[model samples]
Target: MERRVGEQYRITSKEIDQYDDQGYLVLKNVLTEKELKSIDPIFDHFVAGNESEKMGKDFCDMSQPYGTPIEDFQLVNAMLPGKYIPSFSKNIFYRIAKNIADQLYSNGKAAMDYEQFLAKKPTKAEAEFSMHQDLGYWPKTKNTWTATFSLALSDADVINGCLYLIPGSNKETELRSHRPKEYGTATNEAVNRDDSHTLIIESKPNDKIIHLPVKRGDVTIHDERIVHGSGGNLSPDWRKTYIIAFRDERTIAEERAIGFTHSHNDEVDWNSIIK
Candidate 1:
């Protein structure tokens, strides 16, 4: 989709420093009231559409139900509604996300890497987001500035497993080896199980961890290498988040990019295991 972002989204020097140093930044009320209102019903509609049983992998990817039996990870229930959900990709959110990506990407031009709605169904607090860096999974994404903007559609707090990230994790630019295990319809998330959900850094420097209890209109943007994950939802309502990720346009082509699979039985196209 060729989108013209007439108005550029500019961040302050402080925000840039935060993102550069900490590998993550949280911005509140990114969408105005009108935009929020526009997005609300559209997001609701997408969530409702996830209830259909006929969603395919390329379209609305409504995965296994919350109670699917799994030994490796919880049956993670999620949906990537971007390809089929017209309202979201056509609305202001898509444009705004791209604009932000365009501004942050080293090439100053970006393409949509992916979009997904991660949900933690009520009472299943083990949301099963095994912690890992995004770039580790996407080895072919090439070295460029890629970022993920996770916009909060619902209140993502401790109750609903809000995002948590470690500061300055991006200082180490090397992409650590990630185990390419399919977490059972959870995601094609490359995982470093030992580093999941915790950050232990012994440094001659200060260390910080941030837990975002973001409101409806807030967003958390993080670099592809930052260690990130969230807990499960203990709340009564479904905890849903809208994730829009972008990589440099040149990095996402079929040849440059590798396919990620979400099923345990599915095999990755390239070599991912250590002999």
Candidate 2:
């Protein structure tokens, strides 16, 4: 069940208005060391299938393997489960979501969902995420609002390939404006922004920054339109993070009908992941 807005938490009018206009917001240190450590076992259990590689830093691969006929645990979100529930009975995820909901919507209903990526930054293979917004992958014809929350499992900095953002660039529409499918090819928006003047998010462990150095346990509340992505990890350490998507319950049905589907544990789950 989703948490109630006012009942669980509250967001100031100022914060809500800022997110509405800017398309993204960064909340620092939303998680404590104790809170983050509680999730370590779940993450380690999931990544146990993959062999960690050593270069300059200790990291694990979470992305799809290059040219392989074998099953890559890195590409499968289903392999890692339960750690993403956001809020367990004593966990803070639900509380975090409640606060976000209260700020984003006065009505205050936050729906928690799956966790994606138990990613690790590798040394030899620098981690690189294409510049793009979560909204780009969804059906563009539909007029609606959705948001994704990314919780960092490790400290991210410029050397660690922290997230880069073009302030207010979320206002630009890739799906709305007519352009070649490759419009954002160079500036994928998922990895890097196309506009000038980029902002690099520098963060500390348990100290979260939205759309920037995705800090461990720092919940990033972003409008689907936010133009953001991170460069490859240059540091000698791996950066691990979890991503969750949520939206208003009113749009739940529509999101399910048109959103992408995922196959899990030999069964196909449709539209359930979107809401």
Question: Per-candidate TM vs. native?
Answer: 0.72, 0.64
Model 1's alpha-carbon lDDT is 0.59
List per-prediction Cα lDDT, in the order shown.
0.59, 0.49
Off-target runs (Cα >4 Å) in candidate 1 are 1-9, 49-54, 57-79, 180-208, 254-267, 270-275
Say which candidate scores most in lDDT: 1
What lDDT tens digits, residue by residue, belong to model 1 across residues 187-275?
64554322121122222244355678898877889987787667676778777777777776666674234444322222354344221
Whole-structure CA lDDT of model 2: 0.49
RMSD of each: 6.9, 9.8
